[model samples]
Target: MPVKIYHDEDTDITIVQSKVVSFIGYGNQGRAQALNLRDSGVNNIVIGNIDDDYAKQAREDGFSPVSIEEAARQGDILMLLIPDEDQQTVWNEKIRGNIKPNSTLVVASGYNVAFNLLTIPDDMDVVMVAPRMIGAGVRDRYVQHIPYPCFVSVEKDPSGTALATCLSIASAIGATRGNGAVGSSCREEAGIDLFAEQALWPEIMAIFREGFNVLREAGFSEEAILFDMYLSKEPAEIFERAADEGFVKQLKYHSRTSQYGQLSTMNRHDGKDIREKFHHILHDNILSGKFAEKWSNTKWAAEELAKEWKEVENAPIVQADERVRDVIKPDRKK
Candidate 1:
């Protein structure tokens, strides 16, 4: 069966427009989403945050920012846009019992919900409207009337209309603009997000570091190699083209020799072992709740992370990269 994709045509935007939506944490994704919702004519909206700089920014943006407790009490829909690390703490301290019973709970990420870090009430509807892009891109695409990508799902639909409400939010946020929002679950969202952070980036970093080492051993200039590898933003341009065009289709922009070299050498690496390793990480750690459980030990996790970061700072590649930055990026911030 084809996965359900929600579009502006599929969603009744009026459903969300009529509801009182309170956005908790007026920063990052929170502010972008709230502004988009308001511009989409969702008039009954509130911004919730601590009395901080973010709240000040909200006020400057024509919103009357209120306390999290007050916002939780008033809204028919509560969107949790705080960082994943802080969600559980904020929920327990401010939102847990304060959130109105039977009101909808919305999250931009699936981390806490997928791992059951926050216990939700049975009477309420819980859903996710996770943007595939960053907050800035979400707002930018919406403003440009280009449909930005998002993963939306309703976890608990006690109200029976939760799916409709979820789609409505997605539409208002400009997620249904270009193509449509992909219907996905909290677990799937969490698994894929974490897999990229844990599985993919680590391997990428390894490849870069090893390549740097080989070039350095061959008497290449550190500054020259650093620029060639990443600092020149060549890979960033390639990735941008990959997103704008099809991944394979974007290869046409490269020199024929470059394309031929890449395509020919690609067959030598089958990636079967890499696929198996990725599957293990997905199922054994993220999907099976092992990583969440391990991370729940905040003190232990922080200690281990500190040690690992110390090693990262001490790594040869990072040290060389730092020296190269000092030469080429003299005005760069420390």
Candidate 2:
């Protein structure tokens, strides 16, 4: 089904302007959205928790930072831009009682709401405006007067204007300026995002790593392997061109030999089997709340993440990458 898009014309900016907007974190998304909103003429904006490095940075950026509970009490619209794992704890400890009745509670992602990780009050307006791009991308597009597409969802609407409020927020962040915002359900956004993170990204990384190992075993020089596999700009440039034009157009940019080889080998993988596996991972692991349950213990999650990073750092591919970089771009060596 085609999504209904909402643009600046469909949004009432005054609705968002009328409320005090408090960001509950000063992380990437939080800082970007807050700054964009302020620049877009949302006057009543504040940051929560003036204790961390991010909070100090927010203060330096001209935002008055308050505690989480203080922000919840002061703002009519409270946006939780913290990590997904931290949302439940923060909401339970600092937000629930302090959030005003009938006020709006916003989230950048639907993970917590979709998995029933949060218990939102019935009197509040719970909505989501998930940007399709990164926080830096959102800020860049806003400055250029371009729109970044976003997924907007209304999970609860105790206040009748919940959808409008979400659209208004999208407008402020330049998500409604170009092709406009795509209307979505909270569950759909959460499921897709989680699937991308858990299945698609890991699969891509595995392909790259295995390919690198194969080339190494074939006795290719580390520098040559690194450049061909990734480190060089060619792959990134091709992908960027493909995004701007079309994949078919991208194929035209390459030599006929390259195109023939790529097309011939593309179908070598079992597409149906791979898709079925993706479906299994998405439905059983992500949508079924199994992944969320595992990640609920933030401490364990952090340790696991650190362990993975350490493994990546010590991997042969990464070691080869470092050697190649040192030889070609020694200035980058720390």
Candidate 3:
């Protein structure tokens, strides 16, 4: 589908700033949005969570800290910023009974609402404002005084002002500081986010793990490969070149045009395998126990992984890894 973004001029901020805002969680997006709103002069805001620490923190941040039911009852706009799995329980126990007929319900992610994990009441409006970045980036950029865009979707708006309400809330969270409004559907947002996460995250870890293992097994310095790969010495440089133009530009800059010169010719024969290989890796990993085992041990496993990662990160090969083109760029620029 064609992507459409809404600008500040297209949004109506007073539509939401006039209402009583309640954020249902105190996690990354939750805290970021809630605090940003409060800082933007949004009054009558409350933060609710099961955790005392979270509640206390929210209260410390100048928002009213209330029980979930109280927050839902008092709020004209309720933002569900909790995890997808916990949303149902929160709704059933805390929100369902307190939500007024015309109140608005908001979600940052579309998974629960899209997948039918949490069904809203018939009389209420449902909308989503999903920021494309991770929660940390959202929060950190906010701290750094930068802005990012948020994807918005109105699932159900009996009041006929759902779009306006969503935009108001987005503005409260400082989304207007950037490029602003983008149109999205619950299904589309959920599908694309899930697919992108699955494709980029686990596979990236797998590649890192295999590379580190290979270097270690080769009797080479683990720190070298780890630093080279993790530090992105080569990748960063290539990216800089690519950013200025394209991969070919990067290759030319590095005088490696001849090294990849034959790749274009080989594509006719090997290109067909890319899709098949991706499918095989995806399905095969699922069919095997490898995926599950990766997280099986939880605590101990994560520590071990981190330790290994740290070792690799401190490796010497990290400096000369061919995959890294501009490791110094990130290290020095940042």
- lDDT of each prediction vs. the true structure? 0.91, 0.88, 0.73
Candidate number that wins on lDDT, 2 or 3: 2
Query: Which run of 10 residues does model 3 get worst, by summed lDDT?
Result: 286-295
> For residues 23-46, could you state the per-residue lDDT of candidate 2 as single tens digits?
999888998999999998999997
Q: What's the C-alpha lDDT at position 200 in model 2?
A: 91
TM-scores of the models, in the order given: 0.93, 0.96, 0.75
Better of 1 and 3 by lDDT: 1
Model 3 C-alpha lDDT per residue in residues 3-96, reported as the tens digit of each score: 7777777777777768888888888788888877777678778887876787778777776677888888888899899866567767887888
Per-residue alpha-carbon lDDT of model 1 for 109-154, expressed as tens digits?
A: 9999999999888999999999998899888888888877899999
Clashing pairs in 2: none
Candidate 3 regions exceeding 4 Å error are 140-145, 232-334
Task: Report the lDDT of model 3 for residue 200.
Answer: 51
Which candidate leads the pack in TM-score?
2
Clashes of each: 2, 0, 20
